[model samples]
Target: MGLSALFRRKPHERAGFELYGKAVAAARDPWFFGPLGVPDSLDGRFDLVGLHVALLIRRLRKDPDRRGAALAQAVFDAMFADMDINLREMGVSDLSVGKRVRAMWEAFHGRAQAYEAAIEAGDAAALAAALQRNVWRAEGDATPEARLLAGQAMRVAAALAEQPFAALLRGEARFPVPEVPADAA
Candidate 1:
């Protein structure tokens, strides 16, 4: 094998990386920060990324074929791979990278389950509560913006649902642009 061949990703992994990139971009949308009250901090960004990734995984799992499940796993691995690189770039010691990545994986797992359950149940209140806790780090009650964000998430899920599985398999995902709620703005 050529030396460069070692660095090449499998087709599915390449698609997974592309899909994860789209999710990250969607999560970083300024509308989320301005109107939805998603914090622009690291924790906020992580939570948003986790939420988007979870949504994609949920959709992938719906396919009756094995490709969906495989792609979902690849996407998850791609995310943690990125996370490892990010931690190193941020000057985190190599010794701590494993621990940090593990912690992040746990956090992502918990949030994904909560988001999946709420969205699948079509329970906006539960989704809002989960978002409020993770995105806003709030307690007691969900804020109006949290509720609005939950609505936007539902819209995102519906939009994703409308997309063809073939498109997703080809590493393309489309997210609807979020609108500022009248009251939120």
Candidate 2:
């Protein structure tokens, strides 16, 4: 590649990382753990981050430009790199980190597929069920929190759908803040 092309690529890569950071920040919002009842634990946080990233990636994949696809891959790479660092900080042994990361990747893909299908079907019940199974891992009937979380996810997906492709390409994506239900207050 020419030097000018290489230089231009760096900005897009940086933008991808910046966008990934936004996803992580949204996932770590205290409302999710408090009113939303998303468990405030490592796994819970990881799942939230994964969900946001998946939604963004899905949107990026729909863009007509090839740059969107490249940025999406960059975001994915950044997410996994952050995961690896997090695992080490959590005291996971280096030897086992790869195995654990692999498992996490599998979980991510599974959740992404399920979420994509549910979102595409435009069925709230299906989305709730998928959220219950993946996010809450609840058995039997869905819990109230699972339903609330499903509502939040649906809102996020809708908000993302409305975002202009130009903004997304510029890494200016934003997810609407989930409103806490009145009953939860």
Candidate 3:
């Protein structure tokens, strides 16, 4: 490769990290844990981040431009790196961090596939069921908390669908806020 080519920053790498930051910020929104009833725990937070990342990835993959796909891969890499750092900071032993990260990756992949299929099918019920199984795994039934979270998921998906592919390529995606106000909770 030419020296210039080697030194040039990859657009996908820059956009991917920007988009990933947005996903993390959205996932950390307190409204999800408050009015949305997502459990305010480590597992709950991870699931929420995964949900946002999945939505972004789904959108990126659907773009006709090849760069979108590359950006998606970069974003996925960033997410896992963040997870690994989080595990280490939590005092997880180095010997077991790989196992935990792998398990987390597997869980993320499963959810992404289920969510992407549901969104592609345009089946609200399927999306809700997937959310119930993944996000609400601790809840035995389709409780109100699960329902609220499902609704939020649907809202995020729809908002993503409305975004222009070009805007996404520019790392300008936006998610809609839940209809209910956080203070109302």
> Candidate 2 local accuracy as lDDT?
0.83
Candidate 3 stretches greater than 4 Å from native: 1-11, 138-141, 181-185
Q: Quick one: best lDDT, which candidate?
A: 1
lDDT for each candidate structure: 0.89, 0.83, 0.82
Q: How well is each residue in 13-126 modelled by candidate 3, as lDDT tens digits?
A: 767877888888889888788767778899999999999999999888877888778988978988998899999999999999999999999999999998888778877667
After TM-score superposition, the amount by which residue 102's alpha carbon in candidate 2 deviates from its true location, in angstroms, is 0.7
TM-score of each candidate structure, all chains considered together: 0.93, 0.89, 0.85
Where does candidate 3 clash, by residue pair? none
Give the winner by TM-score.
1
Q: Write the per-residue lDDT of candidate 1 for residues 1-185, one digit (tens) a residue.
A: 99899998765898899999999999999988876667889899999999889989888888776799998988898999999999999999999999999999999999999998999999999999999998888886888888888898898888887788899999999988887766657
In model 3, state the lDDT of residue 74: 79
Question: Is 2 or 3 the stronger prediction by lDDT?
Answer: 2
